[model samples]
Target: MPVRRRRSTALAAAVATATTLGATALAALGGATTASAAEAPLADYELTWGIKQSYRTYVGMFGSFTASEGAGQAPGSGAFTFTDGTGTYDTTAHTVDLAFRGRLVSASAAHHFEVTLTDLRFDSGAGEITADVTTVDTSGATPTKKGDDVPLAKVAVTRTMTDMATTLTTEAGEYLGSDGYAGAAGDPLTVVKKTPPTTEPTTGPTPGPTGEPTTGEPSKEPTTDPEPTDPQTTPATREPSPTASTSAAPSAPATTAPATTAPTKGEIADGTLGWGVKESFRAYVVGTVAKGRVTVSGGATQSAGNGAFTFKDATGTYDTDADKLTATFKGAVNFKGHESGGSYGLDLTLSNLKATLDGGTGTLSADVNSLGTQTKGVVLADLEAKSGDLKAAQDVVTVDDVAATLTAAGAKAFGDFYRAGTALDTVDLSVALSDDARLPDGGGSDTSGGTSGGSGTAGGSTGGGTGTAGGTGSTVGGTGTTTGGSLGGGSLASTGSDIPGPALGAAAGAAVVVGAGAVYAARRRRTQGRSAE
Candidate 1:
C-alpha cells in the first residue's frame, strides 16, 4: 500500500509540474503571436507621364499643312517639368505637384508663336493630398520648332490626407492668358491609376524517386490520341469513328466554313455587306493601333440606300477595284462648346481590302477626307490621307504614321479653343474582327458583299471601339499603367490567402487540452490500482 501511495503521489507531482511548464510555454507563444500580427509586409508606388500630338501649321489653297518656324505641334516636341514621383504614398500623407514644362501656343495674334510653360502652377496631388495651381509665367518664346519650358510666380502650397486617386485636368483658360500668353496650351492632361502586380509561389515538377528502377516505357515515345480521364467529352478533341455520323456533333459546322465566298456588287451598292466587314474592324482596334482603349463595337444599323458596311453613325462603299472601301459620317463628337465638338464628318476610304486566298494576309491603306460642315472648335477641318503602308491580315487591318493636314478655315476658327495653327498630321487605326466575320480556311469575301469560297455566317457587333469618341473624359497618359505599382514598402500589407497566426494559437491551445486529458487518465488508472491493492 505504501508503494502504491508513493507512486500516486509521484504521478500527481509530475502532472502539476507539467501543467506549470505548459502554461509558461503557452503564455510565451501568445505574446509571440501578438507581435507577429502587428508586423506585416507593405507595398510602395510612384507616378510618371508621356505625351502625343500633331505638328503642322494651317496653310491655304489646297489647305496644306506646313512646318512651323517655332514650336510645332509635333510629338516629342513637348517637355514635362515640375517633377516626377509627384504622387508618392507615405504613412501620414502623399505629396504632388501641379506643373508642366512644354512649348505652349500663346493667344496673341501678332506673335502667333510658341512659348514655354515653365513653373506654370496648375493643380497636383500625391496619394491623397492635392495642390491647386497658383502661378503662371508664359512670357518667353523659343524661336525653334520644339516645346520650350518657361517659369512662373510662386504660390502658397497646402496639402491634406484624402483617400482617393489624384486626377489632373487643365481647362482652356487655366493659364493661357494669365501669364502673358494668348490661348490655352496643350490638350487636357488625364492621369489613370495603375494596378500593382501580385506575387505568387512558383511551382516545379515533382521530384522522381531517388533510387527506383525504371519500369514503364520511355516518355519520348509518341502516343495516339489518348482518351480523356473524365467521362465528359469536348467536340474539339473528340475522335469520331466512321460510324459516329449519327452522333450529335458540335464542331461539324466549324469544318464546313471553308466553302464560303465573297459578296456581290449589287449588295455592296445597296448597303448589304458580308460578315468580314464587322469582324475586320473588331480585329484592328483590339489587336493594335489604339492605346488606352475602352471598347470597340459595331456601329448603327444599315439601310438599303447606304453603302456596304456601316460603322457607328457612318456608312461605307467599296471601290470598283474591289480592293477599297470608303466610309462616311457626320455628327457632334464632343460637347465642350459650340465649336469644341459639333458638326463634323469624314470619308475614310480603305485600300488593299482584299486578303490572300489561303492565309488571309494582305494590306489596307486609307484615303481619309476630313470634309464636312464645322464649328469654330473643329481643329480637324480637312485631312488629305497621305500614301502610307497599311495592312490587312486574318480579318484585321492596321496603319502606321499616316499623315494629313488641318484646314486653314479650321485654324482661323480656333478662337479660344486651340492653338490656331496646330497640326492634325498622323492618323492610325487597328480593327480586329470577331468570330462571325473571321475569314474561313479560304480567303476574305469579294467587293460585292459576297463570299469567295463557301458561305460564312454573318457577324454581329460585340461593341468594339468602346471608348467615348470626342467625349470629355480621362485619357491614358504616355506613362504605362503599372508605374505606381506596389513594391515592398510602408503601405498597408496585403496577404491574399495566407493562414492567420491567431488560428495557429488556437490550435496550440487545443493540443494543450488534449495533453492534460491524457495525464488525468493516467492518474485515475494509478488510483484505481491503489484501491485494488
Candidate 2:
C-alpha cells in the first residue's frame, strides 16, 4: 500500500443520470462502449463513500438525502453506497478508471439549496477526481440554478483507489466564493469487491425464482393449505374438498401443527430489553456532527440522565428444552436531524428490537430504516451471553450485560459506519415465562451509567447528557412514555483543523455527482452554515 496522510469515505455510487454517466464512460474509454465495457465485469466492484461527514451533517441539520435506483447509504457509516462498479484497472499501463451506477439527492429547502450528485471520474493515473453536477438554490433572488452537467470540483489525491480522502480544487473554492467552502480534506471513499451473498440485485432472483418455480413447490407457500385453491368458494372447479375431506388428509396435520408450537416453546408474557447501540456513534448523531434528536415510543422508556433505552412489552418464545429463546420488544427509537423540505439529511429508525438465543449464543435484530428504506428483521448485533448468564429461575429468565458486537449483516444494516466485530453497548434483558414472573423495576442493568461525556465526572463526548433515552426506572410493560431529547448538543470535544466542523458550513458537496435536470428541496435552514453553491 502506498503511504497516505488520512483516509475518507469515497464515492461508491454516483448520482449522475443515465445519459450523463454513459457519456462519461464513453469519453473515458475513448468512445468504445461496447468494446471495453464488456471486458470489465462491471458488477464485481463495490464502493462506499460519505463525501464529507461534516458537510453531510450540516446538510442534515436542515434537509435530508435520498438514494434510489440501486443506490443506498452505508448502514455502518451513513455514506452513499453504489454497486455494479465498472471500470478498467490496467496494471501494465499503471492506469485505473472506476465508474459506478445509481443516484443520490441531498436537498434542503430551508437553506434554499438542493443538489444532486451526478457523475464522478476517478483517474488514478492522473491523480484527479472530477464531478458533473446540477443544483437548485432558492436562497438567492429569483432562485438561481446551475446546469446538471456543470463541471464541479476536481481534486487531486494519491494514485491508489482503496479508501480515498478527497480535497477541493481552486475551481470549487471560486464557485463557493464566500458562501461555501473550497478546501483540502473531504469525506472518505471505500472500494471493495461485491460479494455473492450481497449480490441480491444480480444473482439472487435467478436461483430462488427460476429453480424454485420448477421444483416449484414448497418454499413459496405453506404446504399446510388444505388444497391448492379455496374449496368453499371454488366448489365445482375441483369441488371435492372442504365438506368431504375435512375429516381426512390435510385437516389433521393443519390443526396439529398449531398445537405443537405451545409444547416446543415457552410463551413470554412480560419482559424488557436495555441497549444503547454504539455509544460514540449515538453520541455523534446526537452530537455536533449530526445534531439529531432521538425519540422513544411504543411503550419504551429511558433511564434518567442518558441511560440505556428500555424496550418493554416483550412478547416471543423461549424453548427451554433446546435452550433457545426469541424475545421481541415493543417500542421504537428514531434519530432525525438535518431537516429540509420535510426530510432529514439523517434519518434512522430502530423498532421492534428483537433478541434470539440458543445455548447462550444469541443475536439482536430490529426493523431498521436508515437509507430511506425499511428492512425488517435485519440482524444487527451478535449477542454473546454465556449459557450461565441466561439461567431460568422461578419461571423467569434474566440476562445481564450480555456483550454485543456488530455482525457483517449488522454492519450492512446499520450504515457501514463501523466494521463487523465492533462492540456495541452491552445488552440487558428479562422475560417472564409465567403470570407471576416479574421484570426488574428500574434501569438496574445499565452498563454505560454515563450521564455527562462519561470519563472523569462523566465525559462530554456522549460519555454525558443521555439525561434521556430509557426513563428512570419506569415499570416495564407499563403505558410507554414518548421521550424526546437530542443525542448531541453543546460543543464538540475535538475541533482540530483538517476535520470538517459545522463552524464553516457547506451543503451538498459530498459526492458532487452530476444530474443535469434533477432537483429536490431541502427543508428549513436549521442553522446558518453552508449552501450547495
Please name the candidate that would achieve the greatest TM-score relative to the true structure: 2
lDDT score for candidate 2 against the true structure: 0.49
Q: Which residue segments of model 2 deviate by more than 4 Å?
A: 1-43, 139-143, 147-160, 170-181, 195-448, 451-533
- Across 68-108, the per-residue lDDT of candidate 1 in tens digits comes to 22213424222222221111111111122222222233222
Superposed model 1: Cα runs more than 4 Å off: 1-404, 408-533
lDDT of each: 0.23, 0.49
lDDT, model 2, position 21 = 52
- TM-score list, all predictions: 0.28, 0.39
